[model samples]
Target: MNTLLKIREFDAHGGPSNVKMGGDGHAQTSTTVGRFVIKSIEKHVSYGKYAAWSGIAWGTDIRIDGGVVMVKFNGSWKKLTDVNAQWGKYKNDQKGVADAVLKYQRTLYPDSPIPTKWLFNDFGHVSVKYFKDINKDRKMNGKEYIMGDFIHTTPTDEAATASRKIFQLAESHGCIHVKPNDIDTMIGNGYLKKGNTIEVHPYTKKAIDASHKRDTAKLPFEVHFYPGIYKIAIYKSI
Candidate 1:
């Protein structure tokens, strides 16, 4: 059995659409988009809060605002106690750090690409990292180490501090943020697993139109397998 994870993202300015998952050509389950965000800062320089990447190249960098790529679930899921717990461990507090970084960005470059308001909380409960390179070869040479991470979304204290409301249009630096309950349901059924491919799609008219046009032919993120394992695909609509 082959599993496909199809994600169709709607326009970032609007609400999230539906996400579908299944094996073969059949649909298993669908979920509504609670809330998600994309990269607001677009630059190549590394800011303390925001990871730096070349804006020239779309998918080659960390900013995945409007792009598509296939990545595998790197490992198992780990449930964190709370947003504070994640901040203490990973030191990825977007609010505090991004604010300081944005201040510095303003001083260094008055016309900085960094957004005015930034707010991001940990996935809340369970989270997983996805990567393009399974092996550590690229990492050893100092190449793109981790592709991106996925986390279950839950309302938290950290989320409240930001000027923007959580789950509305709250943007991420690059990571894929999802609703906690939705992911919990999927994990409960053992649908998501190590080595499962996650296809990230941008919520753009061009990409959506192209996908619709190529509905019949083999699509960009469509997967094929010999058999035995379950194939899951997540399609997100705008």
Candidate 2:
């Protein structure tokens, strides 16, 4: 019953440059996902304002039972020590650009599970959803919007310690926070289930110039940290 599931999103208004967060708080914006689908997979509940600021707003607050799945948008909570101090300062001041972003996240996830820190706030063990729902009535300036309208992706409240020095990552008020074993290996290798069809947008200047020519033809060591201090002194003289 191919309900249509060609999901291929790659947003980066502020996040997703392979996650090292610092600017794109609230999981950044811009979402459409063609027409949205994935109706349900429930059990990791905690809707709206993260269940009124962690007040137990529902059942199963997240432990991966059924591993949350209610796509519509309304989930986000960042602060796992500020995403491990921004990838632990890029693995302590860029250890070869954090080992080439962990070798491009293990060559784009080669069987998942490599997260020691940077869990984007742990996400209650993981399996959140949401990458669509354009604007199902969750009005903005029109008044009548209280983190509702759908854009969720639960899990990641790891007991909310609440620190703030300018921290503002929590904003799944349009959910997309994932990690629970990489959504259980994309729903056990099925590429996500429940009437699939996700496609969130943003990043199209010819897909950012073909992702800068596939990260410079295969992460030339994270493209030598993208030319800054003379390309980090020519990547420390090769």
Candidate 3:
């Protein structure tokens, strides 16, 4: 299964319709992937405005948005979920990061020695860092090591609770949280591995302008790579 993540987006062609077809349903023909623009943003009385990603219910407080997690499985693209493959938030929140990950980071991470008191959501079992916002604008500030953000899914048992929000808190410090099974599916099918080029689209400008920057300086700030051999390929320039 040598499936590669190929993202070739296309613009929608919808005007007066070049021609009409005979059928009970409507259809259009295009030779490329479609990139539809959807503006989803709103302001809160206290917290602020954030781009709400699809599938996540309201009041969840998930900061990740404007991107799709997909994989090529069995000759097709499938939506990849966000969630740590193994550990959930409850187990990973307060000092539950794996030893293998720690050792690997200690040897390769620019900021080696882990602080004794570092207690936050571990970067999950298999995390792939993505280009984070460097300019305080919370938008796509280009692919740079601005934040130690990753496309990770902390394996958790609170999918229903966290997803539906029983007063659910913010998912991660700087990582995108997805369904745990999605992580497994990607890894199992070899859709997510080294050199794979997955795309995370940009957030809306209004969403960006209204977004607030977080202070993750006190914690680890190294971008890209965890213990897993898999790596997310980012080739686009900011």
Candidate 4:
């Protein structure tokens, strides 16, 4: 029984290129008026015939499962190959196959190619992992706490304009908490009949100025005059 083996004619760093297999011997049988030519195969042939001439107990009928077969190198399997005939329609495309291979290589063989997937099974350990736990402190001072409800609701553009106008009037007067009805009449131009809550603050002026600066002065510079309505609150600032 001939011992057939698959031998890589290509180097470990390279692929199968212009290389040939070893061993040979030819035969020529004579008949009545003709001759037949034959060749004796060896134990190892080119990578091209790896799956074709497997000499297992099943003779040369030994079959190799189709797909990328991992080839060994220095006690480890790091690379794969497939028979051209069996490669089917998977020869080439733009599906990032080579990129996937390179990614695998970097994962499994971070340091040296000598230690491949078989040796470095835990590829994840070689990579860097980062985690962060953030804790935020939500605390406000007397002024911010008291003025928090001043413009509490999301207002439409027109309502926001009214809110800003009313806030500006109160800020210019330098007082906090005006009569809700008075503010309604003053800023709402008598449109606001129901009295709710109103507050004025110098800090609001600063906030408005900062916001206006941030918007490159596209926003109104003065304090908000007819600020939008807010839920009533009894809070007061020092």
Candidate 5:
């Protein structure tokens, strides 16, 4: 099946009285791509945050396939929901997933203008690669290959220690999961970064000894993927 995955999201916006008309209401916008639907709307309050109180316009929830690369909204699903505590958390997490998916997709396919269409053209599926650290050049199967930034490294966090954690996270839930061969292309073309540390295990917060250095002799290490759901994508040959 020529399938794509799109995630739905919700967000909120509030500010001072830009408009003091006879009435006040929130403006929400919805979007769709193909069979997939995603909508983002703003909820404005009748009174400012400092005001006694204000009425809220509840947001809607749309379901998107986990495997979809694009979304197509039909303007058919719009419902008012009661404002709740969990809404904020859900909105934040959903947006994170959406943003991460887009960022990773763009990094992987920079030349393609039509992201969804290009992804749908039987280009391939996602593959997860496990590594000891960001600097380590070994693939999961004991082969040497370059690695991409599976997860964004937090500035405060140390890269030399988070490579493994990134690999594991990528293996578990990477959208456009990649394989070792594809990773080779990234390495050959210098798309992969050269220096950084990788976390070995997220659960334990342990780290491997390898650090990113061009000279292999300068840094010596051995690592493996450990065999898991590493990379998730649709392959043309497969």
Candidate 6:
């Protein structure tokens, strides 16, 4: 791994973005893909590979997963969402793949160098033994728990309105989606790169936000959320 960009995903709902997993909209998280490399920054990203489950427009929408994308730096943990930095949402939208991606394509095509199974930048392969890039093939095998889970951008029109650009952000199937410019900036400034570790700290009901005071009583530790730049004040231990 280049440097560990430990992408931690917390469980909370508020402004900006809120993520829920599973078919019932639960935060179904577990030990899954955690580290990998920038497999490819593709333009032609298709979701048809996992369509039977994703049901996210099948082959009609590709740019729905567009934007600049990132590449990394540092060697510490990075929360998928940050108050003062890039915001994110982790969603487990994958059950698994049933067929080859090309099988669903007819009149559709990817952006430039089309990625295998339409997988955009993989962020990096999960460090787990089973999730390893088996067969030494950079492509994810269909048998894997999470395939085609990428950390990239989304279509400008879907997430936001013309007046309030940069929508609060949302979750993309099986992966995490961050603010567009933040992603671009990460890749441009080398804060994010291929071959780095992407540690997805499973989502939980526990969250930290100043906007909600009623829920703090449920937390084991205490976290004070400060507005403005959005800061966190930890009391005792978290």
1-238, model 1: which lDDT tens digit per residue? Answer: 2222345322122112333333323232222221112111121222233222111112121111122111111232111112123223434444554454355435434453453322222333445444444342322223433333343342332233222334532333333344444445555543344433334433432223222222222223331110111122343222
The estimated TM-scores of all candidates read: 0.32, 0.21, 0.27, 0.14, 0.17, 0.35
Residue range 1-238, candidate 3, lDDT tens digits: 1222222211111111133432423332211111111111121111111111212222222111223323232344433232322323234332223443244334433253442211122333345433333453434435534223344443231233234433222223333444445445554554444333233333211111111122322111111111111222212111
Worst 10 residues of 2 by lDDT: 228-237
Which of the two candidates, 5 or 6, achieves a greater lDDT against the reference?
Answer: 6
For residue 155, give model 5's deviation from the true position in Å: 25
Q: Which lDDT value does model 2 have at 124?
A: 41
Candidate 2: which stretches are off by over 4 Å? 1-27, 30-34, 39-124, 128-170, 176-193, 196-238
Distance from true location, Cα of 206 in model 4, Å: 62
lDDT for position 238 in model 2: 15
CA lDDT of every candidate: 0.31, 0.30, 0.29, 0.22, 0.25, 0.31
Off by over 4 Å in 3: 1-121, 130-147, 155-171, 205-238
- Deviation from truth (RMSD, Å), model 5: 21.5
The lDDT, on a scale of 0 to 1, for candidate 4 is 0.22
Report the candidate with higher TM-score, 1 versus 2: 1
TM-score, model 3 to reference:
0.27
* Residue 233's lDDT in candidate 2: 8
How large is the C-alpha RMSD of every model relative to the true structure?
Answer: 17.8, 21.2, 21.7, 38.9, 21.5, 16.9
Runs of candidate 1 with Cα error greater than 4 angstroms are 1-121, 134-144, 157-169, 203-238
Q: What is the per-residue lDDT of model 4 for residues 128-216, given as tens digits with 9 covering 90 to 100?
A: 11111111111222322221012211112122243443432121111122332333333343211122111122211222111211211
Q: Which stretches of candidate 5 lie over 4 Å from their true place?
A: 1-118, 121-171, 174-202, 211-238
Cα deviation of 172, candidate 6, in Å: 2.8
